[model samples]
Target: MQTHYEQEERFRLAKKRVDELKGFYGNLVSYIVVNLGLMILNLMTSPEHLWFFWPMFGWGVGVLFHAMKVYGFTPFFGKDWEERKIRQFMEEEKKRNESFKGE
Candidate 1:
């Protein structure tokens, strides 16, 4: 059985994950909305030059990476790595606190 502190840590991690997902979704919505508006404006102004693709391509790459992070699609430095780092730091902090208490 997990302790109360461990449960709290799990809740915190879950909250952080939810927040990251929310931010990524918001980014995706903004990307789609703004890009569509830009495309429409481009079509209205200059249908021959086709300049909207530049910003769309660049911002689309950023959105793709953000989605990868939120969805855990990458092989390196993924959620497991993040959880391990968090636990490692928490252990270090507990040790530091114990040492301070002893002093």
Candidate 2:
């Protein structure tokens, strides 16, 4: 059973995660709305240059990164890395304990 503090910490973490998800969703909605407006403005004014793609690309990159962060999809130092580190340390500790027993 978790202590009261542990439960509170878990709740806090959950709330933080929820907030991150909410923020990402908000960003996505804004990106869509703003880009649509930009596209319309571009089409109405300068159909030849098509400068709308620039902001779309830049903000697309931002949205991608925001999604990655909110979803914890890091290419490096993610859950896989954490699990590998835990296993490595556990193995090392087991070896040390065995050596101690031999001594």
Candidate 3:
């Protein structure tokens, strides 16, 4: 029952979401591959000092946040909340405009 414009909008949003997923996955793969290399290098070069975990943990946190955002698991201001706020503001603006037009 949706119009063409609505359908196109949906498709656009879906495509954007897919792109986000792709980016997040690429980041994740890079994190793993690079971290593995760093870990091996650290172990070989300075097993006693053990410094690989620092970057690993920091990058892991970043990856976790990226995953959370891409997957819409954000605890605050998630996608649904954002959409609702957008609609709410649009409706309010429409009402205000209509009221002014009546005057």
* Residue-wise C-alpha lDDT for candidate 2, range 1-103, written one tens digit per residue: 8999999999999999999999999999999999999999999999998999999999999999999988899998788999999999999999999999999
TM-score computed on alpha carbons, candidate 3: 0.77
Candidate 3 per-residue lDDT, tens place, 1-103, comes to: 9999999999999999999999999999999999999999999999999999999999999999999999879988797889999999999999999999999
- The positional error of residue 85 in candidate 1, measured at the CA in angstroms, is 9.9
Residue 56's lDDT within candidate 2 is 96
Candidate No. with top TM-score:
3
* Error in Å for residue 61 of model 3: 0.4
The TM-score obtained by model 2 is 0.73
Q: Which pairs of residues collide in model 3?
A: none
Model 3 residue 69 CA deviation (Å) reads 0.6
Model 2's C-alpha root-mean-square deviation from the true structure amounts to: 4.6
Model 3 bad stretches (over 4 Å): 80-103
Measured against the true structure, the TM-scores of the candidates, in listed sequence, are: 0.73, 0.73, 0.77
lDDT values of the candidates?
0.95, 0.96, 0.97
